[model samples]
Target: MSKIFLALFVIILVVFFILNINFPLKKHEIYGKYVNRNFDKPICCVEAPHTEDTLILYEDKTFESKFYGAGTYILYNGINPEIELFYKDFNHSSSAIYKTYFLNGIFEKPKIMLNADMNHYYEKLD
Candidate 1:
């Protein structure tokens, strides 16, 4: 009985540690390192760090930018992949996209959706 209890306890501890832990942590900053000359500089980088992921743009509302967007980011393809992230909008999807080296173009195509009709995708000039 003592051995069984000890084993169960160890298993629980391992699981607990695994679930609460993140690995190969992709360290990112609130402000991205790069800048775009033509477009407005990105307002800010997300606080959450990720090694492999995507961000979708949408029309309006402040979950993110002025565009509707979705993301489905997973770091691996295992029973317990180390990372997980995603977002999506049914009507309009990602148009401007970002690519990563690891996925090798399989999940490489990020997109930006131009939501002009729904709620005035962009603010109008007075």
Candidate 2:
């Protein structure tokens, strides 16, 4: 009887191990948490017309930009190649306001076409 009990226990343990391996634990994939805002570098728009426009990015996935006013930003990057930015008044409402932009360019400096205006280009400050 004892030998039979030991065999059953071993079989149960094997079954549990197999089941656990087949159904892996679900976990959040923290890999590549920040796609764009992972660095401490600041990207700015140095155009004299909008010299005050600056974007300071942090590793914490948060940003502070001064375009017309000071604001906070949340960056979103999933499986898609494009990164989405959500902005809010850091001193005002907590909700972010939507804007239009098709961001592109080199890593050091990024270019954005605002409201589909391809004529004017914004560059990052060194």
Q: What would the per-residue lDDT of candidate 1 be over residues 1-126, giving only the tens digit for each residue?
A: 999999999999988876654332222211111211112323333322212223322223112322224343434423222323344443545333322211111212211112212211111111
CA RMSD per model (angstroms): 16.6, 16.4
TM-score per candidate, chains pooled: 0.24, 0.36
**28-84 per-residue lDDT for model 2 (tens digits):** 221122222212223333221233345544445455555423333343432221223
Model 2 spans > 4 angstroms off: 1-51, 68-81, 89-91, 99-102, 105-108, 118-122
Give me the overall lDDT of model 1. Answer: 0.30
Give candidate 2's root-mean-square deviation (CA, Å): 16.4
Best by TM-score: 2
- Against the reference, the lDDT scores of all candidates come to 0.30, 0.39
Which candidate leads in lDDT?
2
